[model samples]
Target: MPLWFDSHCHFDFAEFDQNRQSEWQFARRVGVSGLLIPGVTHARNLQLEALCQQYSWSFALGLHPYFLAEHEQMHFEWLDVALESSLACAVGECGLDRVLAVDDAHWQQQLACFSTHIQLAKRHKLPLILHIRGCHDEAAAMLRRARFEYGGVVHAFSGSEQQGKAWLDLGFCLGIGGAMSHPGAQKLRRTIAALPKTAWLLETDAPDMKPAFWRGPANSPAAIPLLAAMLAQLQGAELNELSAQLERNRQSVLPASYLIREEPSIN
Candidate 1:
């Protein structure tokens, strides 16, 4: 079987609190060799770090825009300190979201938080684990203006062809998850299929973004193989090849000490 890496999964969430180890072990046994657990809030970093150490998975750190209202100016300061000392693989799952229910003030806070993460990423020489939605063009423009160079994953990306190209130009890999497997995401699927293999990575975004195969109550890392098979089918390539490229993409963007890097078997 092909080795796989879940480039994004919130394995630290409470949904897995009942049996995180067993679920993770199952995923590994089925060829999900590793996963990247992204940070959404400062309070969860310690718990996430402990889990990553125990399970030998990679992780990132940042405040998510989805919860911008809960964030304070001091959170950014705390993040800066943490990023300086923590062994985080990247600096974000943070970015702009035009579809938020927040008012203008919260939106501005989102922009500020994203900018801080960008600055932190640059300062630490770490890439970003982004969470952009409905504001790809604006975010891309901001990144350009900031001269951000370190690359990372664009989680659950569903942008237009031009927008996808913009993120690619900035050296980021677009994360392909259960959403991409949906038949209705015609434009997203078509745009992704056209991009080079290096531009894509696999994720389940668990305890969320359940694949089209089943509308399960919650997603999990174990769903990776299913998503991988779907991605290979969409890309019109062999499963083994897709597996190899996805691994390569992850290592390229988010290198962490815990991850045991192995050479890709694809030619």
Candidate 2:
């Protein structure tokens, strides 16, 4: 079976609270050898850390934009401390979100928070795991100004081809997920198909973006192969070949120390 690295997932979410262990085992049995869990808030860092340690999974720490109201200036300080001390693989799950109609003050706050995350990622020499939605241009502009040295992925990226290329030029990879399997997502599919092979990373963004067949069901890392198959069909490559190439792409962008190596096969 082909091995997979789910570059982005929220295994820490409450949806998996009851069956996390079984979920992990099922994912591993189905060829998902690695998983990256990203923190959404300061309060969740310790929990995320404990999960990563328990499962040997990698993770990123940041303040998500959707929860901006719940965050404060002190949370930024807390994030900095977390990045400095924890074994986090990156600094994010942070970025802009225009979907929410907020006043200028809130928007500016989001921008400032995102900028701080970029600085933290740079200082720690780790990549970023951005969560951008309808603010690709704004996020791109911020990234260009920061000129972050370490690369990262735009998790669950759904943007124009130009936007995707802009991120790639900024040394970022596009996280492809269950959305690619949706027949109505023609534009996203076309954009991904046109992008270079090295520009893509596989992610389930589980318990959220479940595949078309499993719509309304909680997504899991075990569904990675299903997403992979759809992506392979789009890319016109064999499933195993696409899986291997995506793993290489993931390694190139993410922090090497945080990556969990697969155990040796028994005779």
Which one is best on TM-score? 2
> Between which residue pairs do clashes occur in model 2?
none
- Each model's lDDT comes to 0.83, 0.85
Which digits, one per residue and each the tens of the lDDT, describe model 1 over residues 194-267?
Answer: 88888898889999998888555789888989888878887898999888787778778876623434532232
* Candidate 1 ranges with C-alpha deviation above 4 Å: 257-267
Give per-residue CA lDDT, model 2, range 56-147, as digits (tens): 89899988998888888888888888888888888889888887638889888888888999999998898999999988998988878887
Give the Cα-based TM-score of candidate 2 against the true structure: 0.94
* lDDT at position 172, candidate 1: 95
In candidate 2, stretches whose alpha carbon ends up further than 4 angstroms from where it belongs are 257-267
Q: Where's the lowest-lDDT run of ten residues in candidate 2?
A: 258-267
